[model samples]
Target: MTATIPAQTGGDLPAHNITISEFGAMKALAILSQSGKENAGVRVFIKSGGCSGYQYGMAIDDRELDGDTIVHDRGVKLLVDRMSLPLLRGSEVDFVENMMGGGFTVHNPNATSSCGCGHSFRTDGAQSPDGEGSGGCGSH
Candidate 1:
């Protein structure tokens, strides 16, 4: 695996080759607003599992590391880890709300294959962080 740090600039906004849609940006804003303060931002990671290969892992964190890729969209601040930043670049994260369904979804162009649940995917030879790149979903 190529260890790549997300490219950066001295400009006000960080440089990004990724595309984050306005709709998704708004949804992320709402989530940040609802989440209690002190949370750093959202942490999106890759874990192994699902029918595809890798699953996404998201969590609210108040702590941030230096050099993390920070993006300001809508009303929220998002920080992507240096390692995961490259993988998530151009990926859009949005909150889906409905009478019967409400959750987060990622539209990642990097994913070559994704499970029907859309929670997992696989790319080139990357290993899953969910533990052995299988996420224990095979028995499920």
Candidate 2:
């Protein structure tokens, strides 16, 4: 089941939204159950660093902060902070499996360029402060 969390309108905030795939929901649920965190939500955020200037991060969290947007889709809840929402707008979270492994990946529309490993990305107007190049794919 694929569903989108509606974007918040008005004010200076940019229209931001996110989606979760059926496979992603299933995997998240299983992980939550296995980790005894069934009541927790998946927190998705972006931080400085990485080869592309910004990197994605996720974790299981039960506490909702002051500026968090809680999104429910396919029985999974996503917690996205205000700072990361704009950059992650129009993004989709999905689970993919290959010969190497299986994991959750983000398909970000705001990203103009992403590293080969997909863990880091750069937006059109954003640049890495360190001026790094996408040298090679690294383990997550």
**TM-score of each prediction:** 0.67, 0.82
What TM-score does structure 2 among the candidates reach? 0.82
Candidate 2 overall lDDT versus native: 0.77
Q: Summarize candidate 1's per-residue lDDT along 6-122 as a digit string, tens digits.
A: 322233433343334567667666666688866556666655466566667777766666766666554455667666776676677777776968787788878877666677777
Per-residue lDDT of candidate 2, residues 78-102 (tens digit): 8899889888887878889989898
- Specify the poorest-scoring 10-residue window by lDDT in model 1: 1-10
Alpha carbon lDDT of residue 39, candidate 2? 73
Model 1's C-alpha root-mean-square deviation from the true structure amounts to 5.9
Counted clashes in each candidate structure: 9, 0
Off by over 4 Å in 1: 1-20, 98-100, 125-140
Query: Between which residue pairs do clashes occur in model 1?
Result: 18-90, 19-90, 39-62, 40-61, 40-62, 47-130, 48-135, 49-134, 54-121
